[model samples]
Target: MDATFPRARKNQLGYKTSEVEEFLQRARRAYDGRPLPDDAPLDSERIRLTAFGMQKGGYSTAHVDAAMERLEDAFAFQERQIASRLHGDEAWLSEARTTAQVVANRLARPEGQRFDRVSRLALGYNVREVDRFADRLTRYFRDGWPIAIDDVRGVVFSAQRGGYRESQVDLVLDAVVDVMLAVR
Candidate 1:
C-alpha cells in the first residue's frame, strides 16, 4: 500500500492532485487577501484538518476527499463574492467617470488646456493608459465599464453643441495619448 501510494504521487495523471493543489493555492490567496473578522478559529480548523488529512496513514482517501470538496466549495463561494464586488466597483467608477466627463466638458475651453475624459477615467481607476485610445479601445471588449464607449459616443454626438464636429474625436484620441505619456 505504501509503495503504491508513494509511486502514485510521482504519477498523478489519473488523480486530481494538481487540480487540488491549484485549488488550495487559490484558497490561500483568497483567504490571505481579505481575511475574515473571526478567521483565527477557521485558520486553526483548516490547519488541523490539513494536518489530520496529511498524517502518515492517519487519514483515509475518503477523509481527504471530503476535506478537499469542502475546501473547494468554500473557495468557489469566496471567489464569486470577490468577483462580484470588483465588478460592482468598476461599474460605479465608470458611471462616475461619465458624469465627470460631462462636467469636464462644460469646464473645458476649446482653446485652453486640453483634457482627455476617457483616459482620466481609465487611469483614475487603475486601468493602464495607452499611447492611443484607438490602440487601447480593444480593452473594453468586455461588458464592465460603461463610460469608455459613452465618452467616445458622447464626444461624437454632442460635437455640434460643443462647437466641434464628430471628426474632432481625433483630438480626443490625441488627448488620450497626451495623458498616457504625461501621467507615466
Candidate 2:
C-alpha cells in the first residue's frame, strides 16, 4: 500500500515498524466494531495529542500527520452523532452555536488581540487574512448567510506580522465544519 515509502536496509532502523503496524491494526479493529485493548485510547483529543517516536527510517512524518488528521475528523464526526442522539437536535445545535460564538468572540477582538501572536521569527497565517475569513464565517453562522464546507476547507491565509496560531484557527475551523455537517 505504501510503495513510495522508504524502507530500511539490512541492519538499518526503520520507524518502529512493528509498533506502527500494531497501532494500525488496533485502530482498524476499533473502527470496525471490534473491542479495543484495555489500555487503548482513541478519542479525538487523544488522537490529536498523541505522537510517535521516530527512528532513522520511520514512517514519513507527513504521512502520519495526514492520517492523524483524518482520524481526528472521524472521531469528531462520531462524537457529533452521539451528541445528536443523546441530547436531541436542538441541544446539539445549541452546543454548536456556543462553539460558533466562541470563534466569533475571538474574531471580534482587535487584530492583535484576537489570538496568541506568532513570534516575529516564526511564520503563520496572516492576522488580517484570517480575520477576514473569520468575518465571513461569523456571518454564515450568526447572520444566516449561506456557506458550505468547501468554503471553510478552501480558506487560505497570507503570511504576515504575528499571524494567528495555525492550530487555534484550524481547531475552530474543524469545529465549524463539524457543525455544518451535523446540520446537513
Candidate 3:
C-alpha cells in the first residue's frame, strides 16, 4: 500500500497511482509464479501493452515506464528460459529466427508502401516517419546496428490523412519488439 513510485510534479498529470499499484502487484505475483485467480498469466507482451489511466497527482510516468521496461525484460528472459528448456535451444532459436525473418520481410517493403494507408479522409501514422523508423529497424536486424528496445517502444509518429494504417504499423513494431526480446 506504500507509494510504489514517486508522484508527478504538483500540476502535471501522471499514471493513476491506484491502477499502477494494482497492476504492479499482479505483475509481481505473476513473476513469482503465482497468478491471480481467473487472470491469464502475465507475459512480456502483456507487460509491454499495459497502460494506466492518468490523474493530476499520481505515479511519475517516466519512473513507471522505466519500471515496466525492466519488468518486461525479466518476464521475457523467464519465458525464453522456459521455452528453451521445454523445446530445446535449437527449436527456441529457430522460432526466434523465423519471427525475425517475418519482421524483416515486412520492413523490406519499399518506403511509403510498406503498410496500407487509411481512407482519404481518415487519419493514420505519418508514412515518412514510419518509413524512417523502419529503416532503422532494418539496419538493426541486417547490419548489426545498435538500437534500444525503448527506441522502438517509444516511437511516436505524426498523424496524416491517408497515412500508413496505424494498426498495421503498430503490429509490425510489436513483432519487432518480440523478435528483439527473443534474441536478447
Candidate 4:
C-alpha cells in the first residue's frame, strides 16, 4: 500500500506494512465513532497491546512505535472526556485515584517482593532491575516525581532464573499505565 512510515534500512526487518495500515485504518474508524466488525472495540488499552508482524523493508519500527504511542494517548484523552461527561468529574477523578492507590500499594512492597517470583528453574525479569524500576515508580506516585509515559511503557529488564514473574510485573505495569492515562 501507500507509505505510512519510512522503511527500515535496506535489509532490516520492521513492522509489516499491511498490518500497520490496517490497524491505523481501524483506529481512525474507532476514533470517528464508526462501527467496527469485531465485537471487541478498539480503545487505548488495545492500542497499547497492539503488535504487528515484522518483515524486511517494512515500515520503520521506531516511527510506527512513536505513532502508536501518540494514537494511544489521543484515544485515552477522548475516553477520559467521555467518562467525565457520563459521570461527574469527581467520579472520574475518584476512579483514577483508586487505581493509583492500588498500583501504589503494590509498588510499596519491599523491593524484590513487589511481584511474585517464578519457579527456580524458570526465567523471569531480573529482581534487582525490577526493584530499581519499582523504586522509580514509587517516587513518581508518592513524591509527584515527573515521569514520561514512554519511560514506563518502554522499560525493559534482564531475565534471570527465579526472578519476578513476568506476567505479574506486566499486569502491574499495565495498571500503572491506566492510572497515568486516566490522570493525564
Instruction: Supply candidate 2's per-residue lDDT for 16.
Output: 57
lDDT of 1 by residue, 12-112 (tens): 32334444454455456556775445434333124223422233333245544555545534544454455458876465445445644543453343432
Clashing pairs in 2: 15-58
Q: After superposition, how far is residue 33 of candidate 2 from its true place, in Å?
A: 3.6
TM-score for every candidate vs. truth?
0.23, 0.61, 0.95, 0.95
- When sorted by lDDT, best at the front, the candidate numbers are 4, 3, 2, 1
- Write down the lDDT that model 1 would get: 0.37
TM-score of candidate 2 relative to the true fold: 0.61
Return the TM-score for candidate 3, rounded to 2 decimals: 0.95
lDDT of 3 by residue, 1-184 (tens): 5688899887999999889988988888898988879767789999988999999988899999999999999999999999999998888789889989998999999898999999989999999999999999999999989999899999999999999999999989989889889888
Which scores better on lDDT, 2 or 4?
A: 4
Residue 48 miss distance in model 1 (angstroms): 20
Q: How close is candidate 1 to the true structure, as a TM-score?
A: 0.23
**lDDT of the candidates, in the order given:** 0.37, 0.70, 0.92, 0.92
> Which clashing pairs does model 4 show?
none
Q: Tens digits of per-residue lDDT for model 4 on 42-160?
A: 99999999999999999999999999999999999999999988997889889989989999999999887899999999999999999999999999999999998889999999999
User: Clashing residue pairs in candidate 1, if any?
Assistant: none
Candidate 1 vs candidate 3, lDDT winner: 3
Clashes of 1: 0
Of 1 and 3, the candidate ranking higher by TM-score:
3
